[model samples]
Target: MSQETAEPGIEASAKTAEIEALKDTFRNVPGLAGAPMIMAPALAETFATHQHELGVRVHPDLAVKKFIAPFRGPRDAFNPSGDYGAIDTPATPIPVLPNMREYTPHELEVIVGQLRDMGVVNDPEPPRDVAHVVTD
Candidate 1:
């Protein structure tokens, strides 16, 4: 039996449409102007990039407590391995690694271009210098 898969281009387009619709919905909400829309993949990458720093800030004695026994629960209640099992996780349409090094200029341009096309951003060119602040 042959397995059927979604065409990459079509899948991407559908995701883009979904994102645009969500943006439009958010745009109409009061008091939400200028808020940034962060997708899951971007959030995951951002978490990974600054994980060490985050751990230090959140738990100063994390290194010292690293050897502590982890909490155990029923296998059905807690999955230590983080396995999704049969759950189907959709792929991110736009893969973005948010960091000083991993996020490349090309990726920035592509994202900016997409935003411009969606009328979310008006600038013809992406900003040369962007500041990212991480706080505890």
Candidate 2:
């Protein structure tokens, strides 16, 4: 039997509205200013652009950690390199690789533990059984 579904345009518009509402809600919060997930389009961009303007306090959530980890530093710290107007040559993009790094399993565990301490990655999902065989 055929089932009725929302029109693609309507669905898209609804999703857009929902996203806007979420953004508005985020903005209303006391903190989370310049948060990448709340404002930036992609995870990569978020990692690159989000500044930790909330001082030393963090929201203790995965979204905050994922976005803020790369830009963790004093908000008032001035970057001489960031001043592009004084430069005569074209601005060279800072390599994104600086923010992206591979972590070993032990390193990952340490990171997870740190996040846990900060209440960021609390209540992680239980590990699944990978040894089970699939049967038809």
Candidate 3:
């Protein structure tokens, strides 16, 4: 099976979570030394260099938590981070971790690069906001 089978088709995935829950989960990881994931290349690079302070932060469960944290909020369309989201409300797309959707050119490029580095494959026509790159 291709990478698409396990992840999303881009235009068909997206979900939301609770703010308090998300904040709590990350606060409770055991060996929270480094960043398990980074949306920005600069941050990822910084944490990569300082692996001690940010060690293994993204375990399977925590990884999923971090992925959904950005989506916790109102039930309207709104982008959490102007850098990672597009248009107005990002609630819909933001909640959909590991899904797909219409991402800005920059976001797409950066995410695509990260996906490649993380051993994740690219799904051409990803379902809307149900897509994200994950490590195997």
Best by TM-score: 2
In model 2, the worst 10-residue window by lDDT is: 62-71
- What's the TM-score of each model vs. the native? 0.22, 0.23, 0.19
Q: Write the per-residue lDDT of candidate 3 for residues 61-107, one digit (tens) a residue.
A: 42422323243554321322222222233343645455456677898
Provide the lDDT at 114 for model 2: 92
| TM-score, predicted candidate 1 vs. hidden true structure | 0.22
Per-residue accuracy of model 1 over 1-136 as CA lDDT, tens digit each: 9999899999788655544433322211223454333335444334444543343123323322111111243222122322221223442243344674566899888888898999999965766897889999
lDDT of the candidates, in the order given: 0.43, 0.41, 0.41
Per model, how many backbone clashes are there? 0, 0, 31
Please state the error at residue 43 of candidate 2 in Å.
24
Model 2 vs. true fold: TM: 0.23
Q: Rank the models by lDDT, top first.
A: 1, 2, 3
Instruction: Give stretches of model 3 more than 4 Å off.
Output: 1-40, 52-57, 62-64, 68-91, 94-136
lDDT of 3 at 50: 51
